[model samples]
Structure formats: structure tokens, C-alpha cells
Target: MSVPDTQVVVVGGGQAGLAAGYYLRRQGLDFVILDAQATPGGAWQHTWNSLHLFSPAAYSALPGRLMPPQVGEEYPDAEHVVSYLRDYEKRYDLPIERPVRVAGVHRDGELLRVQTDSGTWRAQAVISATGTWWRPFLPAVPGRAAFGGEQLHTVEYRNPGDFAGRRVIVVGGGNSGAQIAADLAYDTELTWATQRPPRFLADDIDGRALFDAATARRRALDAGRTDTGGVASLGDIVAVPPVREARDAGLLKASPMFVRLDRDGVVWADGTRAPADVVIWCTGFRPTLSHLAPLGLRGPRGHIPTADTRALAEPRLHLLGYGDWTGPASATLIGVGRPARDAAREIAGLLRA
Candidate 1:
């Protein structure tokens, strides 16, 4: 087969990919973005129906254009965010190939060969922006397989209507867990479980503040200043409307994680069991880096060691939007732009050299 070549091949067309693309385009690099999804929107398309940005639309935009404000909505919902991302792709006239699932990436001497379902893209450098939505993680609790009731990860969750009247337990302490538990509380007999107590930002603080705090923390660390105890993480829960409503209704409390699963429910460490019909594991995701396994860059924890976004072992490759490791709050919308710009600049310098 004849292999196509480009200066750069971005491995995913989600937020991270698009952000990187914006910088690459400005740099006038010859590149193409390959997205695995059939359509635009990336993981946002699969988020629960009521899922909304913890930050306002302005704070959630990519590099080039601001996300258009929603009149009645303080936070843009999943559909709105997806629409914005789709439009962002078009507005920039980004060269994106859809339905192109990347199989693996291997180094061929000086060039990197990106193996995709459609064909191979031999490029000078590669940016792996394939976010973590595809790899949901469920903890290995005892008797997990023995539980007879329905079990799901947050990825499969779409709407709470299907869970109505059922006794459901939502697991994890992140935003997904909080929002999902809140959504289902009104419809289902619900329980929320976390490994530790859920941390909530101040009521006045939202995504913007979280982003600022993250930025400050990053800056402090870079300057060798260890005093950043007040910085909040992007993963901390933002008091979105639904969650606040749930809190007001006395349904936002979280229980300690159950030690094991039983036939009809879960058992706490104290041996108390609660009947459950469904358990939604909102335990987060592992990076989707199976394609990069051939590179042998992944560590024992399933992460690629990177100096900023650039791989430590392989400078020709970069990983974006996996989490804080790639860049401070790089997994978030507002936080991705800076690392993407820096990565694009690094790639451009390499290509020019």
C-alpha cells in the first residue's frame, strides 16, 4: 500500500487535537487530524444528556474562537459543547479525517509511521491527543462479578430515565460522579460512594476559578515555589445547578466506598449491605494509549513519561489531554490551549530545523 505522508499527524480530533491543530495551522505546518469518531464532538457526544460544563462557555472554548454564549443556560450542556467543537473544526478549516481509528504508531528510522484503519500516515512528528473517554476504569472489588444486577461505567450512561425507580449507586468522587449522582437522585433511589469525602469548591467559585488556581499552581511549581496549598484542582466538584439542587434536596451526600459486592447489593466494611439495582462506576479513565504501546514509552502505571507534553524518551512525539502529567490541567478545555501551543511550537521548531 502507498503510504501518505505529512509533517505532522494528530491522533485524535477531540479538544486536545483541535487545540493543537489551531497552533499547527498558525505555524503553517503540513498536518492532518485523524479522529476515531464517525462524527465530530469527540467524547462530549457520549456524555450524559444533562451533562454541562462546570465552567461557563467562555471559559470552555478552544484557542481560536470563543464558545458562543447560551442565553438561558449558565453552563453549556453536552449538545451545546459538541456543537461548538464541531463548529470550531469548521471555522478553522482544520484538515480532519473522521472514522479513522489509529491502530498503532511505530518509529521508522527518522520518521514516525501512524497506522490507522484507512491507511498509514508517515510523519515527522506525532501528537497523541486521544483522550481517556474510551478507557473507563472499574476498581477490582471483591464479588464484583457475582453481583447479578446491572453494572455500568460512566461511559455507557446517557440518561437517568432508564434508571428510574431502581436502587442505583454512583461511584467516584469527581465531577462525573457528582453530576451523575445528582441527576439520578431525583429519578432513582440513589446512593453516592467515594473512596474519600467529596471535596467541593466554594459556592462562589466555578470552573474559571479552578482554572486560575491550576494555572497559579503550575506557575508556582515552575518557579520552585512550594507554597501552593490554596490552589484547587480542576477535578474538584463545581457547584453546577443540578448538583446544588441535589444538595438542597439532601441527596448530595456521599457514602464511603463499599468493601465488596453481594448478590443483590454492596457491603460496607462494617458488614452493612444496601440493596442496589444498578451500580454506575464513575471511577474515571485510563489514557487510551494502546496504539502507542509499540513505542514502548508507557510506564508501569500506563502513562507516558513526558517533559511537559513532549515525551521524555521520544522527543519526536507528544501526548496531550491525558491529565495533569501532560500539562497542568491539560485534560480540561481551558487548560489544554497553552500546552498545545507550546507543543506545536516545539514541533514546528523541530520541523524547521
Candidate 2:
């Protein structure tokens, strides 16, 4: 096979991509990072205005740089994170192309062909760090099409002001659902619904604890011991300041998920009806992996089965920062470094061999 264009090509310039770039640069590898966004900060730039980190800045950081502290705030907000990410890319001077939407990745002899909006390039290895934010998942709940009120997914929700004076139902029990519901409690007639009772971690619990638990879980699994469920066993929600306050004030109580949606609102399993002017589905997201479909690698669970960060069927492809399947807590800022480091090291070793 002819020489490839570069040693590696990293898709998605978010936290995960940047983390991978850090290690790739350290290894002196020739790589290019293609980011879909027009600018830096990745998904952080698109989160709700009031969104804050689950932990303090010290605990939430990318690989090389520690996120600077935010004045007068324990946990940094979305803007702070965006600023930090922009600064990180500049500080590292990583070769990143902006607004480059990768169309697909396919095998080309001994190299992988990365097709993007701009053009196509071949690399010895491709690291897909595209996280889940782009593909917001909305469940196929009954009567959803007939619901007369406006329906919005978490990605479309920017602030609570848009929901003022409106009767709204926030669906899903995870952090997004809890945080968004808390954000709207004071401004809207809100009902928070979940399939099961919402689980809130202790007031003292934060990202640090969750990361440690996830690390332990990974070690346990590697050692062929029983898994401890990691962060899921602890709780669903992180009890951030806004969520905690809302719950303490009795404004963020959880209700059982409605069986179906009506023209006016949602219908509970107990034959109760709640009138709603809007429904915000914070139902979470799926990994943005459509770009990889050309490879025909996705398994039955709608995921590309992998061992560590490398795709099992395609050793040249590495899926980073998707979720635990990629690495323990790899979706988080701090958690991504370990996996990115490993992936970069492996790619470098392969190139050398």
C-alpha cells in the first residue's frame, strides 16, 4: 500500500478529540483533528445557559491543562467551559480544522479513507471522538404525534425563559431531566416524569466520587470480578446546586412516567391526566456515529463492539469518549484522558511496527 496522508485523523474536536490530540502531539504523530463545530468548546457551547458542572473546576479538566477557577462560583457554568476549551486548543496549538463535517470513514487498502465535506484524506488510523450530544434521543412514546403542545428535546432547550407561564412536562430521570426541570420550576408549571423514582446522590457526592467509582469498576471488570455497577449504582442525578435546591424546596418532585401523550398533555398509568403546554424530553442521547456506518461495523445493540477504545472488527479505528463502552466515564472531561492516552499510544505503536 502507498503511504497514507497522515499517521492519524481524529474526528470531532470536542473534549475527547482534544484529549486525543494532546497525546498524539506528544508522540510526535502527524494527525489532523476535524471538528464539526464552527468554533471551539465543542458541545459545551450548545448547552443550556444555566447548566453548571457537577464538580468544581479543579475536578473537571482535560488532559494537560487545569480549567481555571471561575470567580464566585464553585462549579463552572457552560460559558466558562466553552472559554476553557477554546483556550485549550489555542494553548496546545493542535492542528484542528473547524467546521469540517466528516461524511464517512471507509477502509482503503492498508489505510482508512476519511471522507469529509471539504475533501477526502487517508490515514493509518482514525480516532472517532464524536460524543453523543448531536444525536438527542427521543423515545417513541404513544400519542406523541398528536400532542398539540410544542415538543422540544434537551438539545433545543437554551433557557427556562422560553417556558415561562407555560405548563410543561419534563421527561426522563437523568441529570439533564433533573437539571432542566429545576431550571424551570420557578418559571413554569412543571411536572418531572421518569420510568422509575429519581435517584439523587448524597449532597456530598460529586464528579470526583463518581470518577473514582467508575475507575474501581473498570479495574474490577478487568480482573474478571463482578461489576459494581459504577456510577449507576450510586444515583442518577448528581444533585447539583440548582437541582438540590429545587428538590429541597419540594419543587422538583418526580412523578411516574406517563403512559401516553394526549392532545392537551400526558396521561399517567393511573388514569390521571395533566394538562401541559409543552413537553421537554431530556431523554438523553446516542453516540453520533453515523459517519462510521460506511464501515458496516455497528453491532446488534446499535454500537460498534469494541475491546477498549479500538473497534474489534477494524483495529485501525478507535471510538473514543462515547461512554463506558469506550472507557470508564470516558464521556466526562477528566475521564477521557486515560482512554485518549491509551488510544494514541496504541496508534503510535502500530505505526512504528
Candidate 3:
């Protein structure tokens, strides 16, 4: 079919996508953003009802808005983040086509052909902003079928209220695991297990985000040409001292081990059998790139091969909202502006070229 032409087509409506769209608008590019969700907030709306962002509100705003300090005094819940994103869309007059899933993307000579559930769009350039959260990694576990318990990944989790009377086994030990375990143990039997001890850091030390420490290590790795080296898992990111704090507060019981899963429940590395009514895996996410799989990815892992300086692998194709989306500055809304601006310049070049 002959597709409608556009200067640019942005995939994914998450923060990165929005930022790219806003920049695209500033550059006067004729573009439309395609998002799978009905609204603009992306997956943040699907987060647990009680979920509050760990980053302060000030750090959460997009390029055009400013979240207040008052909002940051405490964590902003899922709803607040959604409201802010909606406001961003309104301010920019962004042309985001909702619930439009990108079915396929390919190079049709010079133009990128984007076929969505809604229709097809041919763009001179395309921004694959489908943030990294599209896929959830659930490694194959032996005897998983045997453990007839309630199994769920963190994405499906709403809150701990439903877990009031159940023995919940929260595994993987990421922030979700820690927070969920802390809340659930308040009213039910809980065990927070990790394959290895995670690097636990203070949420804020004198107003500094703990994630900065991990970022520093990552920067060093990148500097040493080890961007794809054996990076630490969730447990490795959790430091020892704060982990003790979790144990001392009775928020979690240290079960530094992994066991087999079966109909009976989980069996720990130390040979302890814990009968769990629910198993919540707090394991992290996989970059959702299913639609882009046929695009001839140039990276070793599933990621598109992006040069150290560029966020796109080929002409008319770019990516934003990656793991190191913008570096230590990633922790602040301030960091988003520069990258968005850079993306805007690149999109402008495409429009002009």
C-alpha cells in the first residue's frame, strides 16, 4: 500500500519518545508519534497504583515543564507522573497517534516504511523511541511449572494489600523487590531472596541519588571500552549497609541464595524449602524491540548498534531512552534537555537532507 509521507515518525510514547517529539517540533519537522498505549504516559500509567517515583519530582519533568520542589519532598506516585506527561503533550501540541502499534519498519530504498496497526506512514527519518521497557526478562527456570503457586512479574504487581495473608516470595532484589518485600512483610510472611547480595545504597545521601554511584562505575567501564562487559545484576547494585538496614527494619529477611522451583514452591541454595503462596519476580526489564527485530540489528545483544556518539545505527533511524540515556545527569530532568536537543538537530538534518 502507498503510505502517507512524513518528515519523521517516532515509535514509543515514553519519556524518551516525548522528549524526542518535543525537540522535533522545535525543529519544525513534520512528524507523528506512534504509541501502542491509549494515552501519552506510556508504561508509567500501568505501574502499581501505590508506586511512587524514587527520583525527586524536580528530576522527572520533560523539556518544557518544571515539576515543583513541593512535589519532590516525597515521592510522586504513578498518577502524578501521568498528569505531568499529559501536560507536556498539551504544551508541545505533539502529534501522537495513540494505540498505534508499529507493526513493521524497513528501509524502502531511502524512506523508512512504518506499518502500524492504525495505518502505514512513510517517513524520511524515524525515531525508535520505544523505550527499553517493552520486554520483561524471565529466564527459563527448571520445574517452574511444578510450583503451582501464583506467579507474577513485578510489572503485574499492584500492591501488597492482596498479599496480606499469603506467604509471598519476592525474588530478584531490585528496588521493586526491596520495596514490595518491605510492604508485604508488614502484613504477611515474606522472604526477599537474591542470587547474590545486591548493592544497596541510601535513597538519598545529602540530596544525592544512590544510583549515581552505579553510574560512575558504568562510566568507568565505558571509558575502558567495556560497555558490554559483565555488568552487575540487580543484587550487585544493592550495597551491604543499606541491605542491613532492610533486615534491621524487618522489611526483609536476608535469603542470599537461589533454589529450585516446583509445585512445592522455591528451594533455596542453602537447602531451605519455603512454601510460598505467591512468587513475585523483581527481575529487571528487557528492551522491548520485537517490532524492530527484523530491522537487521547491528549490536551483539539485541540492541541496535549505536556508536558511542550517536543514538542511531542508520540514517532515518535513531534511539533514545537507553540504559545510559544521558549519563549521571540521567537522574535529573535537566539531563533530558540536551539529549532531546541533540536529537532535534539530527532530525532537522534529516528533514533538510
Candidate 4:
């Protein structure tokens, strides 16, 4: 349980962290990857059992590691992805310290202090491969605590059987909400909450037309272009099952967000009453940055700011695994690795100096 001081410490162990670790290994830098989970894979392991990659298998591999699934194969399920992460770690012999939650990161002279649950670690450079999609977000409704109803986030949902033979109002109009509602439509009356009509990407318009362009932009961490808060403009990303299937059903209907939570059901912003026995908040997630105490977080009501342009701030601080496009790939498992590779070079130079 003793925390040793390392030259470079990578926080987070998903695609981004692993990619950075790969680069560090090539550069022969001394570092350790600290993951909060008891396992290697990040959020992918927590995804619904049936969730699959939207990207073609050819496009999903990290810098050096190859995803075992064949190119253009149907999106591999979460099980495959999780297994592959373990394989990736084993193949590289990555120095990953699991279940070591970074509690705080602050300046300590020339090195960075990384405090975890068991002990404290130090490093001259800290690569926060901690991605943007960290904490799940569900809106707080009035009387939610008092409401006597089945409440759960979409993450906790396995399938429609969770609400079998019951009325379910799904909150949020993005990918998860649409799919969950559609799946439950046969047995349950479903309603979807939305700020406005959900902008769904049609099959023909969503995806990377060329790998070269996608690779370049990905390496850049293209976060500045996305709007403050909203779903990815799912214009083109390959025909994921969510869009096609949801569209096939009439369940894609999105109503105004619920104004309040009643003991019996949800009351809409337009003063409409909808009866519901279960409420699934498909509201999405927020980036986890509690471990980052030193980097003053951005925004009062919007998403993470991509405006910090300092590439060499404090000669040690670094942000990794941020978005590349104003696209779903940024949020998807397939998108994080390239940015991590680019970030590693920048970090190495800072340490070498």
C-alpha cells in the first residue's frame, strides 16, 4: 500500500490512459496508470450488457493494440470490449494500479501530488487521461425524493424487463433514452422527455468518410467546436442500431421535459399529466474531475470548456482523452486513443526539459 513517486503518472485506465501508457513505454518513461475501478476497462464495462460499438472494427483499435474483432464486423458488445482491455493490459504489461482513486491533484514544487484512497503518489507530470464522461447526470425534479415511484438512471437499466408490464416514462431524448423506450414499447406505455425534438442522425449521413481526416482531427482533441450542452449532431457515424430501430417504432416521439415528479407519474412542462409506474432518467453523464483540485474547473452551467490553450502550463500539468470532433466519436470508446498518443509526446517534452 505504499505509494511510490513516479516520473509520470497517468490517471485513468481506459483507451486514453492505455494509449498514453503505450507511448510512455515506447519512450521509456517511468510512469504508472492509476485507475479507480478494480478493473482495467473504464466505463465500457459499466455500459448496458447489450451495448456495442458504433464504429466499424477497423476504426476502433488503439495506436498499437488491435481490437480482435474483424473490420466492419457488427459492433462488438461490451463483453468483447472489456475482455479486450484486459488483454491489452496483459499484452503490454502496463503498470496499472487499480482501485487507486485519485483524491486530489495539486502543485508540490516541481512535481505533482496525487492523493488516492490508500496513499499518496508524486510525479513530475500528471496525464489526466480521465475522460469527460465521468459522472452520470440525472436532473433533479421537485418532489423526486418524496415521490413513491421506481427511479433509476439509464445506466442501471438492463432492458425493458426491468419495467415489464408497467408504464415507463423515459427522461432524455438521446441515444440511450430512445433505445430503452423503444425496447419497452411492446409491453409498456412509454414517454420520452426532451428540451426540444430530438435530432436524430439518419443512416446515410453519419460517419467518417475518410480515415485520414478523422485521424488528424482526432489527434487534435477537437473540443472547441461542440455546443455547450446537447446531443452529438449524429449526422454521420455509421448506422448504429439505436437510430434505425428507434425510428422504426413510433417511440421516437419526444415531449417537453417533465416539470415535476408526482407520486403517481410525471407532470410535463406544458401542464400535461402522464401516468407512469417507473421513471428512467436517461439523462447522460458529467465529466469526473473531483480528483483534479488544482485545475480550476470551467463553466457555471455548460459543458467542460476547451478554451484553455496553454500547451505547457506550469511545466507539468496536462489534460488527456478530451474530444476530437463535435461528433459522437469523442464520447465513444473508439475516439479517445488518438488524442492520448498526441498528448503523450507533449507531456514527454515537458518532462525532458
The residue-by-residue lDDT of candidate 2 on 1-353, one tens digit each, is 22239989999999999999999999999999999999999999999999999889999999989999999999999999999999999999999988899999999999999998888879999999999999999999999999999999999999999989999999999999999999999999999999899999999999999999999999999999999899999999999999999999999888999999989999988899999999999999999999999999999668999999999999999999998999999999989999999999999998999
Model 4 segments more than 4 A misplaced: 70-73, 132-134, 205-239, 294-315, 322-330
Structural similarity to truth (TM-score) of each candidate: 0.97, 0.98, 0.86, 0.84
- Collision count for each candidate, in order: 0, 0, 12, 8
Ranking by TM-score: 2, 1, 3, 4
> Who wins the TM-score comparison?
2
Candidate number with greatest lDDT: 2
Write down the RMSD of all candidates, one decimal each: 1.4, 1.7, 3.7, 4.0
lDDT of each: 0.90, 0.94, 0.70, 0.69
- lDDT by residue (tens digit), candidate 1, 73-160: 9899989989999999999999999999999999999999998889988999999999999999989999999999999999999998
lDDT-best of 1 and 3: 1
Q: What tens digits encode model 4's per-residue C-alpha lDDT throughout 1-353? A: 54778989888998778877998888778999999889878878887765666555665777677788844456677778888888888899999988888888888887788888868898988877777556678777896876677988877888667677888888876667766766777778778777667766666442343333454444444455534222243322234676467666655677888789878887876778888788888887766667775655545443334423113334465566654422224434565555565556767776787
What's model 3's TM-score?
0.86
Q: How many clashes in candidate 1?
A: 0
lDDT of candidate model 2 versus the reference? 0.94
